[model samples]
Target chain A: MLETINLTKQFNGQVAVSGLHLNIEAGEIYCLLGANGAGKTTTINMLLNVFPPSSGDALIGGLSVTENPLETKKRLTYIPENLALYPNLTGAENLRFFCGLSGLQLGVTEIEGHLKKAGLQPEAMHKRVETYSKGMRQKVGVALAIARSSDVLLLDEPTSGLDPAASNDFARLLELMKDRGAAILMATHDLFRAKETGTRIGIMNRGKLMDELVASDISHSDLEQVYLNHMKS
Target chain B: MMSHLFYFEWLQLRKTWSFRLTALIVPVIIGYSLLLGHQRVQDQHAQIQELLESEQTFYDDLAERRRAIELGESEVEHWFQNPGNPLVLAQFGGSGRYVFLSPKPLAALAAGQSDLFPYYGKIALTNRSAMRDNALENPVMQVAGPFDFAFVLVWLIPLFVITIGYDVLSREKEGGTLALLQSQPVSIQKILLMKVLFRFLVISGIVLLSVLVFGFLLGIPIGSQAVIPVLLAIIAYIAFWFALCVLVNWFSDSSAINAITLVGLWVLFVLIIPSLISLFASNQHPVPSRAMWVTDQRGIQQAVNEERHTFFESWKADHPEEVMDGDTPDFYLIWMQRLLTNEVIQDRVDEATERFNSPREQQVGVISKLRPLSPSMLMHHWMQQVAGTDAQRLQSLDGEMREFQKDWKGYFIPRFRQLKYFSAEEISQIPRLDFD
Candidate 1:
């Protein structure tokens, strides 16, 4: 589980994320909805401990992200929106490299299994990622997350620019991960996918979280209207 | 953990064809350049041999002419008409005691001082004047230095190190994977250590292997006794560059910035520092003015010319048995005057030369003290010394040549005094100059 208690981030005299509060419990998928520069990525970056929080703290499993970052990192896996990996390596090889860095020693068979579970094709498993499609590359990133055995997955726009079929596959994969006890905190712009896949949704605008609601609290038909209204005010 | 990092480095090299190409090509380029340099030095050694042979011939011709003159022959004057005679060209080779230097094993690795300094020189007999430098070389080429192994190791290898390793951590930041990578269970410190170790191994391996190959190919003499010091120097030189790379990498996380800064460091420590030091050292330790000594000594001869009648009168006054009616022989007086004039010229020139070379020695001393600041320079200087290309080595040669020049004068002056010659055995007895 992860939590950001009054988390704040400032850059060059401007508040990028201000006084934000959130909690992600075990097996829960919390989608942070926002427009461009709505502090969604900033919140994720702070929570991931990429940069120090300006005024507050990001906590992972009760450990402060700033003071105990390595411990916090051990419990989490991050997949950036534009996941840059060694394109010269095969998808399976990239997974193995990251897994090895995290102190895991997966054999050839295990590496293949993780790749397949991430929805990578059998033929593409051995092919260099430089020749991979965006969807395929994202699957490799997901494979690395799975390989790390992390309890929390921080995904930045995991389904952005994915075709419908690939996006659906991604949502199913998230569900599978959630069932496996890995809490997911995904920052995304796809409201409809949020309604379809996320357990809870939070709307954010101008560095502040406007509202959080359970999927059951909002009707699917009116979710867009509610999200629009939240954005306007 | 070390092995893992090394494996990843190997994998990265395999994956990136460009990096592999650079690593492979750089060493070959460096080694071949050194090969060409060695060949050049060998050629110079051959030329020195030919010069020595010609010097022998000149001496033989001088002795033959002097013997003929003693035999009471007038037709033998034609031998003195040619400029190729030792009596004519003997002084052209500087007045110094000559010492010959043989190449050492590590000469191939650095060729440090050897390229700039002449291998042969004549050390002065009296230390009156500075020994004539007269190294067998083109001066401009000496300044530029040869494209040798020292050049490759000191300057070019660092460039390769920067190109391959400077972006080790920075690329992750640029690609947005730094955060992700850091999120793993690995310690950042451990990761950095592994990266640096991998680079060190790769570069050091390349350098060591190339040097080993050159040693075998060039056949530089090292009979197990002197090999360790040579190898140790090579390793220390390589480590200097490796440590520099680590320090520079720690300061910047941008590959571009790292490359530029590292190159700047290379230029500063390797190229700029040595050159500036050389310049300041020369200014501080200035060489004595040989031309001015020649002028001053020539003035002494002019004084001798004015007092010629007085010298003849004095000789007649001392040697009554050889004088008829107190009139000394014209030939004997002329020979005495030539000998006395030669002595004055030698003394004045030697004094001025001593003044000129004093600064050069001081400059060398100052440059030597700067060795700790730049190990490459130390290695370079040592290697050149070993290869007989150092100026000091040439100075030693000059020292020998000066002794030989004195011998030339001694052999002729005594015979001229006795007024005797014409034995073929005596013609062959004239001492020939040896390079060593």
Candidate 2:
């Protein structure tokens, strides 16, 4: 379960994210659609407690991210726009190392199994990450989330630079995490992906939430028109 | 957790070219420096041994000739060569003794100020002065200093610590791994501390192992009590630099910024602060030049020469009974003026010497109190002290010889004033050099 209580963020007297309230249950994917300055990343950063909220709180499984930073961080996984692993380390080594930071001591076979679940080929998992494609790196990030069995997942434009096929594959991974009961919050600019994969879609303009819709209640064209009209307004 | 980190860090660092280069180059430099230091200590020992042998032979020949002359077997070829005269025995060429300081077990660790200050000196009845070594002729030492273990420990090894530790936290931020790392259960402070600690251990281990290995190979006493202080000082010095690196990395986000900041700190603490402290201390307590002191001594000699006659009359008036009843011997008459004039000159010269020495002592005191501001200076002084080669120890020669000179005079000055000639047996009673 993930929740925000009137979470607000400001930078130098400018509001990056205005008062926002969201309640997403387990097994739901809440995709926040916004343009470049829509405060989607700011909201996710607040939840990650990358910086403290100007007012109110971002909570993970009922624990405040700011007050219980390390404790709440233990229950979640974050995938940023470009996931950077140690370029000098093998995919498996990078996995083992980051997993160790979370107190997960996955063995060689277990690490390979998790990579496989995240749709990485067995051969590519042992190679150095400097030789990895962006898609392959994102798969490693997904594998980390699966390995942690994270209670919540926060993704900030994770699939922004991937090809259409890679983006579709990532959409499938999100679906898999959703089916496993992870409450997911993804910030994105893609309306089609939101309609196709998100359980609930919230469109934001500037710093305020413009509308919230069940993914099933909106058609693909209708979602596009709504996102455009909100942008024009 | 430590074991796992050890293996993990090894796996990561083994591929790193910087660490690999450090592993290959640092040992060679350290080992070579130790060998050079050992050779330096050896050369000092050889010179001391040679001087001692010559001194023994000089004394033996003197005693032998005195014995032959007392029995009327050998004739005195020249008045200056007469072994019976106290002046001849105390002041003639090849007659004066030399006092030397032997090397300690840990002397090989640092050359320090020994190469600039003499370790041994000539002790004569008229004047005692320290003899200088040939360090001034060494351009390499003049410019860059000798490649001794102390030089490597104090100056070069900190660069390697910076190499390994400068990027402990900044690399994560630069590589975009920091965000993910922040979301992990571990605090960044713990991770930073551990990384800095690991690198500190690595550099310290390399230095200690290399020094001991080369040290034993060169026959430097690896078992001496002196080794403990040297090793402890090395560890503390390494920790000081690594602590600086960690502090810089605490808020630095770019590897470049951290590198620049750490190197700047090294320059500030190692080079700039010490130079400024020495400059400040010197300005506060300025010593007069050596040439001025020499000129003062010459002036005292002239003044004392003029007053010698008056001083003799004053002494005669005080000790009429001790004055001889008959006409004095030519030897006693000449020796009295020389001895009395020398006594008055020595007193005046001491006053002048204090003027030269007092301000220098004050300068040393000021520097001593300010040494803690720069750890590099602190480490240098610590190495010198532990190795028994510090300026404070070498400069102690002046005071030590001052006492020894008094004892030397006590033995011969009384005999010279009484016009007493030595027999063969009395020659053995002259004071030998035994300083504590």
Candidate 3:
């Protein structure tokens, strides 16, 4: 489980994220939707302890991120939009290295298993990431997350550059992770994907949460209208 | 975690073409340097051997004459030509011994000031100036300096280190892996430290192996006391460059910036700083002109010539008991007057030489104090000292040579003053220089 209570972040005299509260339980997928500068990534960064919040706190499995960053990091995996990896290393090698960082020593076969589960083809596993597409690199990121078997996953625009087919595959991978009882917080601008994959969607505007709704309770068109209205006002 | 990081770093380095190239090139350069140094050592040995052979031939000729005279040969053309005369023997029978400073076993590793200064001196019974008779060498070669092992270790190794290490962290950050690495359950500082340590070990290992291989090839005694100081110097110099690389990488976010900064530091420490220190030391303590010393020696010789009559009269008065109503041989009187006049000139020459050397001593003192400012300078000094080619060691040898010359003159002056003729056996028993 991951939670943020009254989380706020200020840069100099300006507020970037203000008074945010969220509760994501195991087997939940929470997508943060907002325009640029709407504090969606700020919220995820705070959750990852990339930076300290101005007030309040983020907890992963009930452990404060600021007070126990190493412990919290061990329970969570982060995948950024670009998913930068060692270009000289093959996808399987990158996955193994990350897994080692997380203190997991997986055999070669097991690493291949994680890569296949993350939707990377067997033939592409041994090729250097320098030749990998953005989608393929994301799959390696997913493989790393799966190898860690973390309870919480924080992703920042993970599907921004993926083609429609790759994005669909990524959505399916996330759904599988959710079914296995992992809490995920993803920040993205893709309203359709959010509606298709996110268990719940939260709309943020001007560093504040403007609205939130369960995906089953709203149509994709209606959520888009709501997000546009918030951006205008 | 550290071991895992080291493994990954090793994997990457093994695949890096630049690293492999450096690893191969360093040994080749070392081999070339060792060969050059070995050739230099051989030249020095050959010169010393030639001088020794020439001196032995002169002694052999004198011995032949002594044997002929002992066998009741006809009288020589003059008494002074007699090999049995103590004065004639001292003058012509190899009394000008060559005091040669043999090259140390590892001297080829660092030529140091050995190329600038004479390692051999001819010490005769005359009061000639010591500064005028240095071995002739090509001035341009001395200025260009030898590309020996010490030059490679002190000047070039650091550049190789910077080439491999400057981008260790910045490359990761630029590739966007640093963020992913930071997301891991490890501190960034520790990761960078491990990365630097791995590269340090790689470079240091290569440097040590080069030293050992070249030391063996050059016939340097790798287990001797001198080897320890040279090894310590190599370790410290490599460590300094590694630390500089890490510090630059810590503050730089781009590979280009890291490279520029590290190379800038290399130029500053290796080339600029030592040159500046040398310039400042020389300016502050300029070596007195050698031309002036020569002129002073000429003037003193002229004055000695002018006082020859007075010198002979003083010698006669001091040796009244041996004079015996003006019965002393003219050869004996002339020899006594020359010895007395040489003593007076030597005192003045010694005083002037001391004054002339004061500035050089001051410069050496200043350089010793400031050597720590540049690792290159420190390493150069260390290698030179270990090779027995440093100025201090050469000066000590010069002092010992002067003492031996004194002993040589002491033994023969009394025999001349007593007007005693030397036998073949007595001439053989004359003091000879032993360098121990």
Candidate 4:
């Protein structure tokens, strides 16, 4: 489970993320939809403890990210928007290195299995990440989340640069992870994918969560309408 | 976790062509430096051997002449050529021995100031100046300096270190791997440490292996008392460069910036700062010119020659016992007067030499005190000390040789004053120079 209690962030007396409270339970995919400076990335950065909040807290698996960063970090995994990996290392090697950091010692066969489950082609498993496309690099990011087996996954713009087919493949991968009872928070701008994949959604504007909706209660156009309404005001 | 980090760094370095090239080239440079130093040591040894052979021949001829005179086989034409004459024996026999400075066992490693200084002195009844006999070397070659182990360790090794370490962090940050790495559970500081340590180990291993191989090939005793200090100095110098890399990496976020900053620091410490210090020391305590000293010595010699006739007659009147068969006008009086006048001139020469050398000694003293400001200077001093090629050690040896020259002259002055001819047995009993 992941939760934020009135989570807020400020830079030099100006608010970047202010008074945000949310909960993501097991098997839940909460999609945060927002404009460029809407604090979606800031929200995720707080959850990752990239920096401490001004006066709020994020909890991963019931542990405060600020108070018990290492413990909470061990239970969660993060993938930045630009998913940069060691270019000289193969996909499997990158996976092995990151997995080793999380204290998971997986063998070669198990590593390849995680890569396969993340929708990466078996042929690309042994190729260096320098030759990887943006979509291929995202597959390695998904593989890292799977290899760590973390209960909480925080992803920042995971589908921004992918083709429709690759986006759909990534949406299915998230569905598979959700089915495994992992609580996920994904920040993205694609309304269709958000409506299709998220169990619930939050629309953000200028460092505040302006609205929330259940994905099943609204159609894709309806969610887009709600998002635009928040953005306009 | 540490081992996993090291393995990752090792894998990356193994694939880096620049790193591979540096690893290959450093040893070849070291071997070439060792060869050059060995050649220098061999040249010095050959000169010493030649001097010893010439002295031996002189001794053998003198012994043969004394035997002929004892058997009454030939009549000598002139007192100057007769081995029986004390004046001839003192002037031409083994009394004019060559005082050779043999190379230290580990001298081939550093060369140091040995190329600029003389390793031999021709000691006779007159005072010998070590600096005046500077081994007839080409001035241009002296200016270019020798490519020796000290040059490699003090100047070139830092470049190799910078090449290996300058991008240890900045490259990862630039490629975006740093974010991914920081996202992991490990702290970024530990990861950087592991990366730098991995490179340090690789470079240090190569340097140590080169030193050991050269030590064996050049026959330097690796187990001697100087070995540990030399090794410690090398390790300290390597550590200093690595520490500089760490400081540069901390403030830089781009590989190009890190490289430029590190190379700048290398020039400051290795080349610029030491040169500045040397220039400052020389200006603060300037040595007098040797040319002026030579001019003063010549004037003193000319003055003594002008009074030579009166000086001999006064000495003959004072030491009437040494005058034999007054009608013959014994030539021993002339030789005694020459020896006395030469001793007075030697005193004046010693005073001028001291005045000329004081500022140089002061300059060296100032530089030695300032050496810790740059590790390169410290390593240069340490290496020279270890090899026994530094100016201080050579100066001490020269002092000992001067003392021995005095003892040699003292042993024969009384024989000349008593007008005694040396027998073959007596010639063999002359005080021989023993420098170990």
Candidate 5:
């Protein structure tokens, strides 16, 4: 459902992301593990067509992102590290507004039902997003994906500052989305979450994807060692 | 899709504190300016009404006195006091009609140059001059101008536009919703356009409604089709300012920077460009100072006075019929000499005055040509023109009075020159100042 063929980006002749290839099918969470400036977010941005790729192409559901951005965008949802919604609006309103942009009309009950499924408290759903914690905001982002029934989900460091339980709750939401047949790509520095929640993991260093491994084949400690070694190199 | 964009945009704007403040403040200022404009035009109407009334009374008294004399009810004690005498009817003391420019239907929209030039003037047999009510006073008022609808729309309305639109796109980017919006199917450019257009609609609608409502309450004849051109020009002017805001937003990402840039542009277009254009236009076509015109008028009067005896002798030789052969009143001989000298002086003064005013007319033409550089300036001039309160309209008083003076002289001077007299019944047949 999500693919990149030799995707690369540059800023004033300095490489932000080198030529790279990635593909993730439905019902899988592919986590990109990297240190800061490792070009993980750049990869997600290219796939989202925020800016065109330097040389190669990113495709979603077999449609080229650069060539048909709106067509591909219709099938995806992005939740950045700090997902910013209208601070003056309630979480439910934010969800409804985004859904409206995606051309989906979800009623109040349906919006509430989706928020409930994403583990947002019934009390917080009607409250302004400015009053929401980072973890609670992530739940709203997850609710957007559920309401839209997006085929692809791009997350960039979405759980960096959350408490342990909130991170775990977010992991559970991703798993639920994965089971519902959504291809998820998350960029993170957390090895444990990558090992536990990610169906497959790729460690990146200096704008290059260094290695890929199935989550079940690697222990949390080994994944940490691999990430640390990649960073050192 | 556009409806959805408008609805959401309105919702967001209403929630914003700045927008809420603007919603309340803008209408108040606009309404107040309209009220001031109404009052200004009302004052002009009052002046015209006063002059017309004074003229009617002056003529009625003359007719009554002449009727009594013809009925053999009273004896004429003095020639100067005789009602049937043409010099008495034309020039004794405030005897001629006062001609004035009436206010147009949309006069309440802009005071314009009405306060800087006379709209009414008196026409006598030998002299015509502008009569001022409240024109050309303090220099400060000239710089500040009248507090009218034109000032509000051309100068203050853009501030509201900038306040609302300066951060239309930058807010979304700075708030970090841009990333999420980018992931949506819509382009940011579309969103930017939508936001700017929405702001333009809000500001324009509020101002238009305010002007209409205030104009209605003030009985300003807003129902007249004459207001349509001014209304359309107003909208176009507001759009010009909004377009500038959009242009500023396109290049800047920070709301502060966008606001500063838009304000800088507003200063350039509204305040600086018009001032510079005025300065440049003045340089292109220089008009002599009002002081110079005054000195020239005094010089003409002195030159004409020095040749007054020669001019009277020439007049006596040219028209022998106007001279009484024998037993004429000494008062008649003295008044006839004064009348002939006044006509000669008036002719020379009119020529000098034309020379003085032609450059001023050219200066106004140059300014009009340069108005396109600043939309605010162009819009202000348009509003004034529609209101009949522009510099050209006010300056036209001299010409209108001159024309009316010809008619005044035509009616009374020929009769006075030929020693013709008629009874009170012909008083109504005398020319009355009529303006459509």
Candidate 6:
């Protein structure tokens, strides 16, 4: 579970994330919808404690992220927007490094297992990531998140560069994680994908949370209308 | 967790072409430089041999003429002053001072101090000042510089460091993986340390291997005791660069900017500072005029000879014990008396000139002492010292030859004046003017 209370962030006298209050529970997929520079990334980054909030707090599993980042991080997995790993390393190696950083000491065979499960082809496992395609690299990122097996997953635009098929596959992967009782908070501009995969969607604008709605309560077309309206305001 | 970190770092480095390239290029460059330096030394050795042969011939001709004087050959005395020996003019052309060349085993590594100084010198009697500069090579070549192993290590290695290390962490930030990596259970500091250690291992190995190859290819037999200090220098230089890399990485959020800043710092430290210090030292303590010293010594010797001739005329008036035999003509009296007179003047002039050159010698010493602050300068200083081509050894040998020349004068001057026949035993015992 992840939650934030009136969290705020300021950079050089300019506010980035302000008065953000969110409560999320295990097994829920919360899509944070926003336009570019809407502070969705700032809110998610603060929750992950990559950057500290200027005012208020963020908590992961009842532990404050600011005060106990290590513990909070221990319970969380993050998939960055670009998912950049050491380009010199193979997909399997990238998975191993990030998983190891998270304190998972899996052998080569076990690493290969996670790579296979994350939809990376076995043939590409040993090849360096300089040879890997964008979609394949994303699979490696997903493998790291799954390998960590954290209770919460934070993804930033996880499907922004993927094709429709890959995006569908990613949504299914999120569903599988949710089924496994991992709460996920994703910040992205893909409103349709959010409505498709998310349990709850929050529209954010100009460092403020404009509105929150249940994805099932709105039609897919209406979801865009609500999102556009919120962003326009 | 430690094993995982190590393995990942190893894997990352294994696949990075840039890291591999630096490792390979640095060693090859160093080894090639060593090879070239060794070849240069061999060529210089041949040239030294030719100069030595010509100098030996000049000394032989002088010794033969002195032998004629001991044989009661009074007619040869007039010709002795003008030996007209081709080798004398060609080889003893700058005789009067000696320079010693020492042998070195590892001079090929840098050819450090050898290039700037003389390896051989000429010496003569009676304080003749022409011998001070026997090896008259081009000065510009001495200063233009040589591309040796030390130069490559001191100047080029930092550039390789910047290329391999500048983007270590900042690139991840630029790529948007920093947040994801931080979100994991590991400490960022540890991760950064692993990265730095990885680069250090790669760079350090390259440096050590290159040094070893230099030793092998050039036959540079560095002592076992010297091994540790050489290793220490390499490690310290590398550590300094790595530390700079880490500190730059700490603040900059982009890889490109970090590279630019690191390269800029490298230029400032390696190129700018040394050049600036060298410029200042040269301007502040310029080498006291060699030309002036040469001219002054010559002028003082000439003045002493003239003064001694006057003293001899007064002394001849006071003493009849020095009267020439009836067979000796007045012109011969004048020549014989003036010759003896100039000997005293020669001795005094030599003493005065020694005093004059002492400050110039001290100036060279001061400059050498100040060289160590710059590692490049220190390396060159020690390199020449070891190679036996440094100024001190050369000048000291010249000092020894000056003593030999004085002995030569003592043996021949009296015989030439007395016109006495030398017995076989006395002729055999005449000391040979040998220079090593």
Quick one: best lDDT, which candidate? 5
Best by TM-score: 5
Q: Candidate 5 docking category? A: medium
Error of 6 at A15 (Å): 3.9
- Per-candidate TM-scores read 0.77, 0.89, 0.92, 0.93, 0.95, 0.77
lDDT of 1 at A161: 86
Clashing residue pairs in candidate 2 are none
**Candidate 3 stretches greater than 4 Å from native:** B49-61, B71-81, B127-140, B321-330
Q: In candidate 1, which residue ranges exceed 4 Å CA deviation?
A: A5-21, A52-64, A206-208, B40-99, B109-118, B121-143, B221-340, B358-379, B386-388, B403-436
TM-score of chain B alone in model 4? 0.91
| Tens digit of per-residue lDDT, candidate 1, span A105-154 | 88999999999999999999999878988789888878877777678999
Give the lDDT of residue A21 in candidate 1. Answer: 95
What does the lDDT come to for candidate 1?
Answer: 0.71
Model 1, residue A227: what's the lDDT?
81
Q: Write the per-residue lDDT of candidate 4 for residues A42-101, one digit (tens) a residue.
A: 998888777899988999888998888778888777877889988888999989988988
Docking class of 6: medium
DockQ per candidate, 2 decimals: 0.43, 0.58, 0.70, 0.69, 0.77, 0.56
Q: C-alpha displacement of B155 in model 5, angstroms?
A: 1.0
For all candidates, what are the clash counts?
Answer: 38, 0, 0, 0, 0, 7
Interface RMSD of 5: 0.9
Worst lDDT 10-window in candidate 4 chain B: B127-136
Q: How accurate locally, in lDDT, is each candidate? A: 0.71, 0.85, 0.84, 0.83, 0.86, 0.72
Q: How does model 4 score by TM-score?
A: 0.93
Q: Candidate 3 or 4, higher TM-score?
A: 4
Give the alpha carbon lDDT tens digit for every residue of B203-238 in model 6: 888888778767765666644565566667777777
Which portions of model 5 show Cα errors greater than 4 Å?
A10-14, B136-140, B283-289
In the order shown, the candidates' Cα RMSDs to the true structure are 6.2, 3.2, 2.8, 2.7, 2.0, 6.0
- Of the pair 3 and 5, which is ahead by TM-score? 5
Q: What is candidate 4's lDDT per residue for B132-163, written digit by digit as tens?
A: 44453677657656688998999899999999
Q: State the lDDT of candidate 5 residue by residue for A5-115, as single tens digits.
A: 998899899898888899999999999998899999999989888889889999999999999999999999999999999888889988888888888878999999999
Off by over 4 Å in 2: A10-14, A54-59, A62-68, B2-7, B65-85, B221-226, B306-333, B418-429
